[model samples]
Target: MAQEHLDRLTAVDASFLVQEKESSHMHIGGLIIAEGPPPAYDDLLDSIRSRLHLVPRYRQKLAVPPLESGRPVWVDDPNFFLEYHVRQTALPSPGDEGQLTELAARIFSQRLDRDKPLWEMWLIEGLSGGRFALISKNHHALIDGISGVDLGQVLFDLTPVPTQFPTAELEPWRASRTPSPVRLISSGVLGAARTSSRLAAAVLRAASNPARAAGVAKEAMTGVADIAWATMNPAPETPLNVEIGPHRRYVTIRSDLRDFKEIKDTLGGTVNDVVLTVMTAALRNWLHSRGVRTEGLELRALVPVSIRAKDEQGNLGNRLTVMRGALPVYIDDPYERHRAVCAAMGDLKESKQAVGAEVLAGAQNFAPPTILAQASRLNFSTRLFNLLITNVPGPQFPLYVLGRELLDVFPIAFLPENHAFATAIMSYNGKINFGLLADYDALPDLGRIGEEIEAALAELLALARAERAGASGNGAAAPPRIGAS
Candidate 1:
């Protein structure tokens, strides 16, 4: 029992469990289209329900004992909270994009009940084009991005064939059995010892190499200073920073990965670099068209960098850190902006940004839940960055569910305080799907940003193709011209 409790606690800490006030929920919003008539959505729901019963982790809840005596625990309840995790809703008349987006916003704003498992799946139906949507919101405590993706594999079948889930019953005494006090004390001691050892080692390592340690300390101080500066001098008040109601607006733009690859290949940068470059160009044009003069405007965007291993797939939680970079909106020349973005990203990659994020995540593991949660809230509420941009890599091959071929997949990133808009880009089945979530009031014309993104990519694609044509003499290798679909 003590071992089980410890394991659960480690899982929670590993997931960076949010404190009560801080909103640490990450959303995995997918826009799935069924080729044929929608299959029994209830049947899929039942499959999930049955599977949840088998996974003890899903049935576990946050247990805060009497204030004076015990720490939080993860005790399993005999009667699982299934309803708290799965929900079904139907769209109103006309069932258009507008209606669906409004519903999604409402869903995003609401917090998940903490007493039960932290996750919810909404099976939405009623689309004009005979399409339905499945939006799943899971607490960051459940899994990181890789784990979340892995959970999708568990819940969904690659081949359209449905499989049976385990439905074995456990003994009645399972829920009532609590960890023994002795065992709990021993486990706590061991956890404390491990933490102490890590701290001691870090100190020793720092002492052994004074110069290297000094350099690391300098970098840490610089990072802290940068964060402090950002908080003191808030980012420019753009349309993205404002009060947002409990309303969500979603818009998706699909582009071929091949087109992006062509641009990357021509430009000598990663796919992400090209994507950010395109985003900068789009924002430049969008703001300029709105009569907002582009001066020394540096839009700080939070780019989520995945920290999962190459082989570790399908675990969900937020195993990511925000890489703050200045979007070169002031650069009048699109080509110059792209080059500057690439250089900026290159510098960030060379720095210890990723390493620092992992270290910060490690620190959270030993931190008291309350302190960690407060820190998270402060970090986000401080406007550390202007907006969020996340890029999640999806399965390269086609994925099927209950014999239905997935037409496309879009990821919806949750909005934090001060930053009302988030852009999530996911690549699935040869195409890139960009989903934008904005506070309805602040970004009333958020949909226009979607159009801008498309236009920017098209511009880059054209430039890449023209450059290829000029170099290759034969136009066969040139990328296809992009046009409005």
Candidate 2:
């Protein structure tokens, strides 16, 4: 059966598209270094080819309506060629960690071609050790699942044994004639009319149930108003925000997830609090090294919160909202910083900041694609938030591809316009991995920031261990107090 209805991009997702520019590439990706006896490049390509049906979006290309009439839609690319997207490459002779990081950074700096499917998979071989790495990239619009996070979990299995995926029946490719100009305009008009009708219906229903509708409307309006008012002030100017170049530099940081949990469990704060505490400390140090004074400074961070339900794992696309978090940049003490972050996050949660922001974001669904894109650009150009930091949890158990044991997984997140640095955190097995991305020229000392993160975490971990030891020596284990919702 030929599909008739177009798969359109939601306004929130379209916002990402409009926001993307030469300096800022909006994609979420990961670098995976696997263990010995690497599989042949052909075998890996075969594996991905066989499973493309399971992820139909992989072969679909974007179709923008005429004159930006409406949001873009997903259309099967009749000229889809798997080899163009899945590539093979070899690292320099005596491939070492240094060379691999450089290679990954260069690959990440290049933007994905919007004309084809917005994704790529590089099968890299010839490492210093008998190992290989897979660098995967996908546009923010494609894998924008809950919280706007994904390392392509759908492409792997839980164990090293490659489970044979039953071949799913796929639709054969058949090119359709291009839509007429009249057809595109009609589509846009229809979309707008539908939105208007829904608004009218909502009003009528509210009029019928005056009491219930008024209550709901009042609450929603209040939430949106509070969020808008709170964000009117621009974020503090800092070295972290600057004019960025088209090139990007990548850095990775590693730590045990248990260390973070240990600190949170014993210190009476959430895991996120501990993470922020350490991140703030590192950011403070990094800025100080750049000769910037950090006294009485509070850097705002745009943190993504996913509203997708647990069972909606396989359904991709953006279902995310933003939370404005105030990082305590002035606080020098690690424990004090942790407490401050916990308190601020707790308040933000209580205020339902994300809820209000989401309500406002939902309004975009009724907006035109052009208008939505420009609005996002405005937010990016003006330093609305100091930066973005996201922590996504990966599988604790091992995942494999073509019988290869997946080792480390580091996620490289998007850096918006004028925003020079961003961090994407992911924890797998026993380790928490951090991928730091920065403008290649603006932040050449990016590794210094990564080093600080590691150093700060190490300091906090040592303190937590000593504290836990003291409590154990004195009495029974202290119960953890819950704070954030």
Task: Specify the highest-lDDT model's number.
Answer: 2
Q: Give lDDT tens digits, candidate 2, residues 30-106.
A: 88888877788788887887777777788788888778788888777778898999888989898987788888889
Model 2 residue runs over 4 Å out of place are 1-4, 145-151, 168-180, 197-212, 476-485
Indicate the residue-level lDDT of 50 in model 2.
Answer: 72
- Model 1: per-residue Cα lDDT at residue 145: 51
Q: What are the runs in model 1 whose C-alpha is more than 4 Å off?
A: 1-28, 53-56, 65-73, 92-94, 164-191, 198-234, 289-291, 474-485
RMSD of 1: 5.1
Candidate 1, residue 191: Cα displacement in angstroms equals: 4.1
lDDT by residue for model 1 (278-366), tens:
89888888788778877998888877677777665654335666567778889977656777888888776656565565556566657
